[model samples]
Target: MSELFPDGDEARTLARLHERLARAADRDALLDVGYRLVDSPVGPLLLAATEAGLVRVAFDGEVREDEVLQELAEQVGARVLAAPRRLDRAAAELEEYFAGRRRRFDVALDLRLARGFRRAVVEHLADIGYGRTASYSEVASLAGSPRAVRAVGTACALNPLPVVLPCHRVVRADGSLGQYAGGPERKRALLDLEQH
Candidate 1:
C-alpha cells in the first residue's frame, strides 16, 4: 500500500499524484518552465516553454521569439526565461553529432508539446535506430495505426525532438526523401550523416 500523508492532506496529495501520473502517461504533457537556444547547420534554433516543459522549438528563419514565448507562457502556466542552458547539453551533443563525433543525444528533452497520436508517432520515431530509415507507412504501422500515413506525416511535422527523434529517418514509400519541418537540405545532410 502507498504511504499516506497527514489525513486530509492525503486526499490532496493523491489528487496531485494522479495528475502527475496522467501527465507522465502523456509524453507531451509536462508542467514546467524552461528555455533553450542552440546553433544548427541551418542557423540558430530557439526553444522556450513553461515549467510544464518545452513548448516551442522554432527555426532561425522563422523569427517570432516574443510571440512564441508569450504563447508558451499562456499554455504552460509559467513565465518564460531566456536560459539557453536548458538545452546547452542538447546543443553540445548536436554539435558533436553533426560533426560526426557522436551518435545519440544525451540531453533532457521536454516532450510536452507532443500528445495523442503525434506523441505516439514521435516516440516510435525515436526508436527508429540510428543510420536507419523507415517509410511513412511503416512508421504509421509501428504507431499502431497502420492506415494513418497522413497522420504520421503530421506527427513528424510537429516533432520537437528533431534529431533525437530522427524525423529525417522517415521517408516516402517511393524512396524519396519527403518534406522536413527543418527543410529538405538539412534532412539530406542528416541522412547523409547517418549513411556515411
Candidate 2:
C-alpha cells in the first residue's frame, strides 16, 4: 500500500493527466468506447469503458497492450480511444483501493466480453471481498460446479476485470497464490495490500 500514494510533483502531474484524459475522452460520447492507461502501485493498467459501463482491464506486463486494444475494438466496437473521462470514476476508486481506503468498488460494468461459465465466475468473484481469500474449488462450487476448479483459474486468467472483480482473492486449496494473469508477484502484492 505504501506505493499507492506518490508524493510531490509526480502525483500532481498524474492527477492533471487523469483530468485531461477524462475531459478528452468525454469529447466523443457517441463513440461508446473510452480507455486509458492508469498508474498504480502494482504498475500501469489499461482501463477501458463503454456506454454500458466499465469494461476491460489489462496489466502492463501480463498482456500485450496493442493486442488487447485491437481485440477490444474488434470485440466491443471500433471507436475506442485513450479517453480518461470515461475512466475517471474507476480510476479514482482504484487509487483509493490501492491507498487502502476502499474495500469494494462501486462502478458500473460492461460484461459482454465474458460469457457463460466464465461470466458466472466473474460475478462470483465480486463476492470474495477485500482482504479475503477464497479457494478455487470454493469459488467453483459457488459458480455451481465444485469440480470445475481448473476452469475457475482459466476464468480468472481471462478475467476482463481484475482489480474491480477482485480475482486476486482466489487461491489454491493449499493456500498458495496460483497463476495470475498479471503473474504471481502482483497477485501477492494485491493480496498483501489487503491482508495488511
Candidate 3:
C-alpha cells in the first residue's frame, strides 16, 4: 500500500507492522479454502488461499504441503480444500509465461507480506519487463537509496511474488545471476526461458 516506502524509515517500520498484522490475522478460526498444483520452469508450484485471498505459493522441497496448507488456513481462518479450477487462470497464465507465450502476469496477488524497502524494490522489479535485467545497485537507486545495493539484494530475497514481481530480472552488477528464493539455478532458468 502507498508503494511501501513513499517517505523514510518511519514509513518502513509502519508498513512492516501492517504486513505482520496481515500475516497474523485469523489465527483461531481457520474458513473454507482452495488449492492448485501448477507446473513452472523451476518445478511444481502449490497455490493455495482462502475465499478471502491467495495465501500460499510454495515450491518443491517442502514435502509437508498439507502442513503448509493448514498453516495458511490457520493464518487466514479458512478451511483448506483443493480447487484447481479456482486457480485455473493463475495456472494457465503461469504455463503461458513459462512457455514464453506470455510476458506479463495477469493474476491478482496478495503481497501484504511485502513492505517498506522490499516493497519498493519489488515494485521496481515489476517494471523490469521480460528479457530485461537490472543490477542490484540499479534497483537500490530506484528505491531512493543509491548506496543500498546489499539492501536491494535483501529485498529481492524477501520477495513473495517472485515471477509476478520479476525478482529474477535483477542480477549482480558484474552480469552474474544472483540469489533467488527459488534458488539461483531456477533463476537462471527463468531468465533463459524469458530470453527466448
> Which candidate wins on lDDT?
2
For lDDT, candidate 1 versus 2, the one ahead is: 2
Q: Candidate 2 regions off by >4 Å?
A: 1-28
C-alpha local distance difference test of each model: 0.74, 0.89, 0.74
lDDT of 1 by residue, 46-164 (tens): 76644443446677665466765666677565545555545556567778877888877665566777899999898788778788889999999999999999999999987866777
Sort the predicted structures by lDDT, highest score first: 2, 3, 1
- Considering lDDT, which of the candidate structures 2 and 3 is the better prediction for this target? 2
lDDT of 2 by residue, 48-78 (tens): 9998899998999887889988999899988
**Reference-based TM-score of each model:** 0.74, 0.86, 0.73
The sequence of per-residue lDDT tens digits that candidate 3 reaches over residues 115-163 is 7887788778877878999999889988899999998999888775677
- RMSD (Cα, Å) of model 1: 13.1
Error in Å for residue 74 of model 2: 0.8
Higher-ranked by TM-score: 1 or 3: 1
Model 2: per-residue Cα lDDT at residue 143: 96
C-alpha lDDT of candidate 2 relative to the true structure: 0.89
TM-score between model 3 and native: 0.73
